[model samples]
Target: MDHEKVNILLVDDQPAKLLAYEVILKDLGENLVIASSGREALEVLLKTEIAVILVDVCMPELDGFELAAMIREHPRFQKTAMIFISAIQVSDIDRLRGYEMGAVDYVPVPVVPEVLRAKIKVFAELYRKTRELERLNQELEDRVRARTAELENSTAKLRESEQRRSMAIAAGKMGSWDWDWISGDWMWDEGQYRIFGVNPESFEVNPANVQALLHPDDVDQLRKAIAEFNKGARAYETEFRIIRPDGEVRWCVGTAAATVDDSSRVVRVSGVTVDITERKRAEERQNLLAREVDHRAKNALALAQSIVRLTRADEVKAYVNAVEGRINALARVHTILSLSSWQGAELSKLIDEELAPYSLGDQIVLAGPEVQLLPATAQTLALALHELFTNSAKYGALSTRSGRLTIGWQVEDQLLTLSWEESGGPLVMTPKSRGFGTRSLLASVESQLGGQAQFDWRAEGLLCRLQVPLTRKTATTTATGKFEDASSAELQRASG
Candidate 1:
């Protein structure tokens, strides 16, 4: 968190309620800004960084709902908590409307002092942590820049043959070692031993010890480079993998040049070893990202071809429109995946994006706990949802003014059960044969997600149910080159 004291904003036209809120929160030892109306609250918000805003629902000129809507429009207050305090009875519809308007929580009048204080404290602490993480990230970036500058400056001096390279390596906290070719002697700095996971007491800088630490695949290349240098090559340079005592392999770049005396006779061969594991890993990640981009592009092209082959219509324009709609659905899910860093996205978000053009006022209903899906599964679900939604908009529930739709999900034993039920639409009847859209929906649910899909067509409406099993692959790789996945391991153990 930041070192500055926390600040909270209280908005209420009634001075008495504002004072009462202040009295309850005064013990928290924080700065409190009081505003009489929504306009004043906006002015205060623009001036100060407040963790949470406590606004009264029934304020003159501008109420809490209006104030919250205004605040949400500004990017600065996106993360700010908005709590609406109402003394009058708040009906279910009113409370839902308040939530729909961006109220984080509702604190009715005769507010419990402890409850209000607890809520304020929680938000304040969350804001503090967010600030703290940003600060640390900036600090880390600064350190990396400084160290990179030092390395670049040292590179110019590296042209000269001396122990200067070791000095630079040490300054950058890198491992380095020197070898004497004439005497067949090897010496390593403290950093070298640390990097190799070697015990100083038992480890020695010798051919035998070094060979044991070198990976079988890398030893031959390194030896060949050295042999070429011994055969009168001007310089010796090679990058190889070294297996640490703990069996962890690391990348190292070795640079060596033979130092000759006045007689032009080889006197000694000295070199510096610097770990390039992180740099190599970065290159590997870049290659992976490139491959992924290529893969996604090909996947898109293949999907377009499949859509074209499957779609059949009396007119070419109709075929084009059908294929275009499917492609648009794919692109919409791609956008969602990009926003989520390709990890996944919530099902509700995907639905909203697909149905943004249609009006879902009281007609479309969504009910489900937050469920995060894998990127592949999310894309499949998004496409299936788009087909169902488009069909509904065209000739189903959403076609009629009084028609209604209900979409809900339940999770049980790693299986997700989703239901899409439509009612109040015109009389429905089962189609004689499957259409392209129906086939695509079934393929997405059954083939793409490895699940079961069912469709029920009744005179009243259509009901679709999908059942998919969730897989746990919660392993995350850390910066320090370690993989940890408790969930995956636990699942494996249970299955075994």
Candidate 2:
């Protein structure tokens, strides 16, 4: 026990008696406060924490009995022990009164100093022990509360960590399952329930139920894998298909390992299942695209052959050029198709690449907002642009050293208007012969783009205007108009 001083309050009306008692207990190894009256003792008690009170039974106004009664009435001082002292011998009735008023013992006055000091010492030691016990109890309670709080906090963190791990596994479309082979009991995580397309509570664990959900064509393969696992001849791993409750068939890859007992008999099995439906679908789509590409390549070669056969044999150079040009255009279309995975092509990029070979000093001017063209539209546009470039280089503006061409396009009211104008060329006239390239270009623009073309052969140069529907799958024609011709010198001097 920690030995701290205990406070004792001495109460008496006579100053001499108080001094005598104080002197006797001065070496008691405890603190003492002397009071001259019961009233003064009560005042002292209110200001300080007193462990024991020794009071004179005979005093003016309020005596020891009265003071003890008052002290007992207050909850704060209820535990303080009191001893009554008197010069006269205490009667049985008086003694009873003192005890009733919360006194523990009586002492006769003109008191034997040794007896008085010894009794006070005992009460002081008791008071010290009581306070020490109370402090220890409080400390114990504090430690218990802190430990309980730590346990609760740790439990909450563990639950949160488990929830996060479960959500991550579910997002990856993976499921975990456990089975007790001996008992024929099975349990599955939340993700496993989702993969089987059933509420966890509604499903029962049985071999028959599992087989019912598997695709009929894949059930035999799954059974074979399971049989091999049970025989200890192979590790469990298999890819199978399952028909869900919604009639949607999906593929799953399963891998499992078994737990054996002391005798090497399989006791349990645990495994994971991963959904592989998307992988299967992507592979199928890739095969279909390969076949389509092969067919399109053959058709393009046949079309090029037809173009060569129809052209005149006398104009061998022109015919050969036209055939090679058509084949090149088809090749460009195929390249774009491959780049876009056969989806489509950007119109601006397709036009840029086609005109690059014929550009004069790399001056093939291009002006338009970007647009994406469908696969069929891309092929037709490639052929048309190739023919235009071939014709211009052979007999039109591109044949002259001073000629310059401007190609511009705009989309307005769901219609695309593309124009090709030339200047600084030889005097122009309408061509007498309608060549294969010209006829093919006209057919491609009119039939495929659902638009019209107007050819203007002026004294200065040849200008062509094309109007096509901007909206796909629509065949709408709008009027074609040409801007007023500017002088060749003036047009050549203008900025591109």
Candidate 3:
């Protein structure tokens, strides 16, 4: 938002007062829209975007209080700050009336130019910030909408595969078969025959044939599990591939339970077989996707860190350190995500990781209700905190060993409000121009996290506050994208 684009409406019936207000506020570099009457002020407001309104309390018609009440009636000016200027002696009731009319402050005339400018400057800055946040939020929402559409299309394309899996489940248990231990006779249902690709009437099932159907690698394991069941340990369950009559192999799980006679002697064992090829395939596909996502994320981080290193050499080593440190802050989020098997990371853990090096035991205080973040939020917040920490370390409270920092957060209405404050260090100055880090920090909160941020550069130190939407991240990603070092993160990549 350009300074000159934000209009400050100066409303008064007297032309001299209007000119004087203009002269006093011209240096603020904002558009000063002067109106000689309340009607003219309304016209300008309708045609232009006004940030703050300075109105005289004693206008003849549509007076200051009345005009303010009218402005308040309009939704567009609901949040606009109102200031009243009056030369007459005012009573408590008069002041209360001005406030009730939505006046932020009332100035008894012979107003101090500095105080008036200071007040206007604050509102002007606020206007610019609010506009910027709206722009960023719109942009973020657009991206989210686009991404959601892409995901929906992708899911639609996979519908056929999912349907096949559903069919497999609905087809019922693999098949039923029964065995008589003493009689050495076996019976197989038609479902079992279809699974083995054999004609039910022509096929004869026996212990020897059942044994022959087992995959050689799984034969020993099945025998042990079933032997334990025979000794009354538990029901027997095993999954293995079996060669059909036509020499086609199929994956199936077999579960068996023995029936005992009145004398407590085992007479028959009934079992069921279910095909699990589709399920196993799905698991493999999922695992592959996990590996891909982890690979791409780490690779992106590495590329980012490399760019930071190449930004400067010895001449601007501090810049490199600052950038690299922030990248590491991002890496730490990835590290936490890895430790949790790619589930998610905790809020306090992210702050601790970023401030760990500079905290020096008790110099920093951390407090917040426990919260979990998905990978995207974790990464964005980690970087934001890194920038604040970098500034404090360079010029704020953390510059000295004795200075202190406090970090806290809470959630309300799906928004996570966090605060960072520092004390007992060198004096802080608010920068007139923001650099890449500063802009990037704002973007991390407003754009990436879909939240708002405010900074107070007090003489003692910097007090930074941010509100990010409390969102949950998913641990799933497509099996595509670039990789950094596959071998180094192999364990994490394959965690799924």
Candidate 4:
């Protein structure tokens, strides 16, 4: 039901044709981007997101088939709908060729406006649905991660409280009481009075008084245990709750032994009544934590399953490598989150870890103010960084000596903007085809983080800019690392 206008790119060499296409599509109420050539279209794609592409098949520099081939190579555009238009197309062979190059539909020169609109509408709507699905999946993943973090924190706190209670129990004394059956007299130690919340000066130490202090729910159970002891059970141990005078409930463990003469006639009963309230509470918390841990494990396994299912690769080896790399990125982020108890992770630390394998001392420069990323942000961004670093090491600045990579970020207006620039490597050239790595980089920043990513393939190197929206609480005012001012301008100057 919810929707937004999507971009539709129209590429043709003729200005008249471009105008005509625009006029026809303007009624669709979508943003139309015009390009005169395939190269121009590529430039537009690098800067903007085009949901459906309408390209003429007979351009001079790059024909429609060639252009589609190039576009299909890029993971980001692999699923993009491409409609090819040609003035002279009647052969089935040509149509087959177009389809092979990722063309969704082929339109002949004397195009029917109605047919064109209908076809484009279907593809456009499909694109919107696909993106919506992706956004929903991302939201689900983020929620699961946040919930897991909360459960983990609660589990940790419970464990700490349990440990403290255990220590106290070990060091504290137990309440002891002795009852002389023949004399009908009861004697209690100070510990017993304290455990039962009895006032030594006002409360009598008697069996009736003790029974009255028992919790209503626990009274019947205690009576049953005492009856068992009276029926020739020499030793007895039972746990029951006691209500203090002020109405506070506490758990207590009472253990007693009956002393009998040679005739097996009981003479007295002596028992120790210890306050085990903390221990009981600790056990309850431990059970809750166990259930939470099971839940967390399932969430994690589900996330891993999603990753495995969605990952794309051409061959088994490539698929394995890609999946392994992504899993490793998640694991690394998990470690970082664990260190902070899943509150978040440092941005600079994430960058460092991803780049460590390819880092070459001074060739790499990192500058950023302290920024704590939420668990979801940290995870998605870490994978994006890993792909960037892996690509750089294989073909960009980090691939060669005398090359330099500068990474810098700053927080402003509740957004974290980062810049990555590479220089001094072999003459840089834009890949004729993009791959899974590039796709991942785009998806992480744009779809997952609700951000923007820009790529400028300069002759010298590649310059990438990423801007991710941040919550107000994630950024902190701290001294910039490795730079006097962490602004983008200063970073560029420093790199130079």
Candidate 5:
């Protein structure tokens, strides 16, 4: 078979057998290394990159199983395929044991060279394909990077060109006017008359007449901008109020650049003026809307919190405490969202923060792989955790200093199981009444998270378990909105 050459390690107790195996594999056009013993095999592995290993299982000192176990322990050799060769007939149990020792296949002694060669060739082909795929992927990534750089450069140049075009259009549509202190005459552009809402044909061009059209409130600013321009101290650019003959007030952006003659005397100050009334009004409206939105969001948050407090008021005083605690938990979730710009809350962080208030001297034990929760899932989980913590603090494990709470979670396939186990608390019994916290926890988890909660109030302590579907859409949407805009004052004080 025409294939990329690969290295193979052949280990045997007898030199003759090793040589024989080497000769058989020589026709395969692979680099074959002969190891007289398992120890020699390990030494060869350290010095060379051996893709596959063929070992005699019944070695005198360290057997093939022992060598395979050692190889499995080494991180570098963990994925290397091992095939065991033994003269003795291998039993079903022995084959199973060999597999447990990380053996890929077992070949009985008096090995058929053709069968061994074929198996080795198959693995070699797989390794070659894997390497080729990796190389192709790397090359594609490089090309993508180069293309991205070129696109980014082009985008930057395009943006720069657009800015220049905008500047040119602004210059062509607007023109500036200036007056020299020594010269009695003033220069005015046609565009300047348009900017000031006066027709050059109808009005006399003079300094006094220009000052007459300016609003009283903008007179000082106009004087200052002009003074700065005349002194060549700064660019004369400002937005000022101008009143038209019809008594309508408008905003205009004025920019001036000065020119001096050979005598070092200011000759002309030229610039552009553009009406900015609409832009200014839009900005004002945006500010008003932003403030209104902030105020309303805060009010909504406060109302939700109040509702939570009022609904759970009738439960034992402790229930009121629980409701307040849950509200705070909700606030914390919002806080995380605010910090993350409402992206999403980390599941591990949420759990840790919720249990912190009730964690008496590190008695609460939490074990779980880190996972992210969508906003709704986070909200639901926060409420559920708050209820659990509150119940524990009032009548369950958290009530006692010596009590311990074990919280853990696991994801199996599409299902997620979050378990809360309690120990060393006063004997627990099912409550006679299903309290508000209990109902809310069930409703939030089932309705909001689309998950089920199992309650087990046993003699030892309360154990609550949750099983939920890890749907992709729910995760993405919740993740996006979970903590978004959470920092707005409205969200901070929100009741629900």
Candidate 6:
């Protein structure tokens, strides 16, 4: 649409000056209204809407500043652009006065034709844009009033349909997609873009880029499904993997069907894709947990069987005590493993549990660096400690009121070395023969855990040292080879 011309008024007593401004600004394609006096300019303004007013400062009666003050007093011309032209030098005070009277700019004569034309052109264009904006705003308000009734009538049904679509998308983590094979058009909804971790503004959806997002192994699987669909398969569901822009791999299940023409030709394909990553991971965890449960059950049963078969006692009471003690030790370690989700058990906690029953006041000191032992290692260590504690209660440190015992361990170069020392007990002596308890301790530390054990017999007390190697799967240590002070340890306080 052609824009209507806005009027630019030039006011001056000299006809030649007014003519010159008209000649210069005529190329701007705006209507130039020339007036000989300020009174004539006011008359023109009342008749026509003037975008810009150019006035000579030295005019008779109504000078440029007076004319400006008069124009600004009228509300219709308050925002009009006014420029004052002067043949004389303007002082700072006069320029300030002109500004206060609503002058937009001042052009000193002889004025540059380009500068005059540029300033007028800017104001004229601004006026046109302002008028155009006002027109558009009015039109929009009219359209809104006309559609109010129609929108109100359809609001409920539209809201219901939207609610259903939103619920389905949220519950299934699903998104819809369409592809026009004939026109090579690919369309995806917001949910569809989100499933693939795509920024809709940045991603250009096309066949090649879509295929690129697929896992290389699953690309052939999807291709095979498409091939089957072409050969008279109406619908197909396939699970595939998509690698997102962030390099995260997610599983998705897509169910699609083709729109077949009368000649049995496929022209379009539409489908919904659901993210199945979490479901796939859950299934994997379930399978792994089942296998782990079976493996651990058999190991526990076999360990229990070994303790039963090897347990020996001359009397029924002793036999029952030995079997029960060993079995309870095994159960305690198993409890730790279960609490840790079978990941491992902490060394301090295992020792604390085994020694908890035989604790005395400040006589038994236990210290160890933080260490995590594998399930099997923890169980074996627990049994060995039970045997040692049983012997102490019967014949060693715990057997005497003045006896003192200290247990400390440290880790270095993936190896854990534990020291068990006893003192202030009845005089110690070497055993004439290795009993069932001694044999079982050796078998547990050495054979089961792939570690070493040494026993030292002294006149004062019995001392034992155990060295166990840690592997990636077997154990881990957080301490940097520093053993905690025996007095400061919480378990030490409990044992004491």
Query: What is the lDDT for 451 in model 2?
Result: 78
Model 6, span 1-496: residue lDDT tens: 4679998899999989988988888888888889999999999989998899999999889988999999999999999999999999999999999999999999999989999999988888888899899889889888887688568767867988888897889777899999896897999998899999999999999988999999999999778877887798888898999999999999999999999999998888899999999999999999889867876776677667766777779999999988999889989999999999988899999988988887687889988889998776787678788888889888998898899989999999988899999999999999998877787677556654568889998888989999987663332223774222111121112222
lDDT of 1 by residue, 177-257 (tens): 667767889877777887778987788778878888898988897688678766777578888889987779898887777
RMSD of 4: 47.8
Model 5 C-alpha lDDT per residue in residues 203-230, reported as the tens digit of each score: 8978788789999988998679767756
Point out the worst 10-residue segment of candidate 6 by lDDT: 483-492
lDDT of 3: 0.78
lDDT computed for candidate 1: 0.80
Q: How many residue pairs clash in each candidate?
A: 0, 0, 3, 0, 15, 1
Q: Give one digit per residue, the lDDT tens place, for model 4 in 1-496.
A: 5469999999999999999998888888889999999999998988999899999999998999999999999888998999999998459999899999999988888878888888888989998888999899999999999999999999999999976655554457467789896787999877788888878889997768888999888888767866876688898888899889999999998898999989887789898888889998999998877764564455455545655766667799978977787678778888998898677899998988886665488999899899989866787678778878877887888999888999999999879999999999988888896665676567656755678989999999999999998873222234652111112121122223
Candidate 1, position 210, lDDT: 88
lDDT by residue for model 2 (364-468), tens: 567888777766667766777777777778777788778777888888887778888877777788888766666666666675567787888876877888777
In model 3, which runs have C-alpha deviations exceeding 4 angstroms?
A: 1-274, 278-282, 285-295, 302-316, 472-496
Output the number of the lDDT-best candidate. Answer: 6
Name the 10 consecutive residues with the lowest summed lDDT in model 3: 487-496
Q: What local distance difference test score does each model get? A: 0.80, 0.78, 0.78, 0.81, 0.76, 0.85
Q: Model 6 Cα displacement at 251 (Å)? A: 0.9
- Each prediction's TM-score versus the true structure: 0.59, 0.59, 0.41, 0.47, 0.38, 0.59
Q: What's the TM for model 1?
A: 0.59
- How far off is residue 65 in model 6, in Å? 63
Task: Encode model 3's per-residue lDDT on 1-496: one tens digit a residue.
Answer: 3444678999999999999999999989888998999999989988898999999999887899999999999998888898999999999999999899999998888988999999999988888889889999999999999999999988986896766645564486357778886797888776777777777777678756766877777778667965875677537887888787678777888888888878767788888888777887898889988876866567656536443643333457776676678667767887998898767789899877876786478788888899887666776677678778877788888889879999989988877899989999987878997655566667556654567889888988788899888753312333675333421132122222
What TM-score would you give candidate 3 relative to the actual structure? 0.41
Better of 4 and 5 by lDDT: 4
RMSD of candidate 1 to true structure, Å: 39.7
- Estimate the TM-score for candidate 2: 0.59
In the predicted model 1, the residue pairs found to clash are none
Q: If the candidates were sorted by their lDDT against the true structure, best first, what order would they fall in?
A: 6, 4, 1, 2, 3, 5
